[model samples]
Target: MAEKAEDTGVIAWLVETVKTVFWALVIAGIFRTVLFQPFWIPSGSMKDTLLIGDFLFVNKMAYGYSYASCPSIRIARLGVDIGADDFCGFIEDREERFFGADPERGDIVVFRHPVDGRDFIKRLIGVPGDRIQMQDGLLYINDAPVQVAPVGTFDEVWERQGPLGNTPSCSNGPVGPGSICQKERFIETLPNGVSHAILNVGDRPGDNTGVFTVPEGQFFFMGDNRDNSVDSRFLQANRGVGFVERKDIVGRADRVMFSSAGRSMFAFWTWRSDRFFKALD
Candidate 1:
């Protein structure tokens, strides 16, 4: 009888352990899908605003949930004619809740790759019904030069930009040393007086040329690391696709939660002490 009681206790303990782990994962998934998700900037595509190795928290509910994913919005279960959703471009959801809003320009955002389902972070440079063109190292939005200027203090980093479709070095960024973190970077000005800094490495792609028109439900994105970033400019070869879909947007970047180095990713003990707690713009 004693042995039986002990065996029963052990089984109950295992059952409780499994239940705890299952619930923990369920709660984490809910938070990642519904509330906020944590992300780390792996490259300089976002430059000054976001840097490689910079980790941030993205708001998932800024828009709403999408039926295209999760059990709630399953097409087979919820059908196509759903109600309000937190997902972008969804325009509707399940419980009959409704809200109408769209992402605006100059907003830093995270979206799903058009080609792949992976998430990416970028700035909203072009919107629906906008004509964007580039000529003579200038950005023209609606046939006007987008205001950009080089500042003494630049957030760009110079890097080894390889050959890019006959376009030579355009992004002149930096191969920054110990200060690989985002906040250590400086600023740059776009042609339109939108004074923002992007990472510029002395690569060859800043000279990329193409005219893009953002579609109704899509948005155009570019890396702040003008020279080194492979954004909409390099879409033809990007696995994530050139344009971002509305459904991929997870949240708007509010501020930098923390920053570290590219190496800090491996040996966290090597994190630069001075690069901590610097407020993001």
Candidate 2:
């Protein structure tokens, strides 16, 4: 009788364990299939905007369901009915939920890289049907030059490697100073609505020429750190970063949750006290 009772207790514990595991799996599946996800900043592609150690929350719902899993594929039949399957992903979704009414100009968007499908974040510069060009290190959107007003001082506001005048992105033209990162700044505007800041690091052979067209359902993006960035210019030169699909946008940078800088070995741990609670443009 004693042995039987012990065996019964062990069986009950096993049953409870299985139930707990099942529920956990179900909850995880729901979260992954819906709601928001997280992404870490791995590189300096959008240097001045997103830093290397910053951790961000990606709003998957911002653009609706993008990665639905299934085995079936849709293929067009040739003059007769037939089971369809092909290398191209053309299966019609049973249910569709549209997200993001439209991507705003200058909106910082996170997207799947067209070249390799890795997630990338960049600001929208050109939209469908717009012609873009670069002139004398300055950007020209649809024949109108962008306006960049001098706002305080980037060097004073942000902690670069050196003093206010020595930012690498500022070392050319009217402000060109080898002694400092002398370059000009501007506020750029794109057609169909978007405006943002641009940092020109001056006369790098890479920034002087290019005429681009933005196709429907695609956008042209670039980083603010002009000379220091690998953006639509480089992406298009290689013909890889040409167009970012609308469905790829993750979400806008709503706010700057935190910022830390200076000469501390643990820069993250050394928080910028005043800069805390500051909003991102």
**Candidate 1 Cα misplacement greater than 4 A, ranges:** 67-100, 153-194, 202-208, 237-240, 262-266, 272-279
**Per-residue CA lDDT of candidate 1, range 1-281, in tens?**
99999999999999999999999989987776667777777665665566566777776556564532332232435455321233433442232212424666767777655544456787777777777765654566777777665554443233422112111123332225423222223353444445566544432544646778888776777766665566665664644357665654556676676776534555566454554554554
Q: Which ten residues in a row have the lowest lDDT in candidate 2?
A: 80-89
**Error in Å for residue 278 of model 2:** 5.4
- Candidate 2, residues 1-281: lDDT per residue as tens digits? 99999999999999999999999977865664465445444454555566544555555555564442111122335443221122113632222335545566777767756544455777878887878777877777777766655543233222243112223444433333324433355665555445556655556765776788888877888777677666676664574467766654545554444544433326655565554444445
TM-score of 1: 0.71
Once superposed on the true structure, which residue ranges of model 2 sit more than 4 Å away at CA? Answer: 1-29, 68-100, 156-195, 236-240, 258-268, 271-279
lDDT of predicted model 1: 0.57
RMSD of each candidate?
8.0, 9.7
Q: Considering every candidate listed, which one attains the maximal TM-score?
A: 1
lDDT of each: 0.57, 0.56
Residue 191's C-alpha lDDT in candidate 2? 53
Candidate 2: deviation at residue 272, Å?
A: 5.0
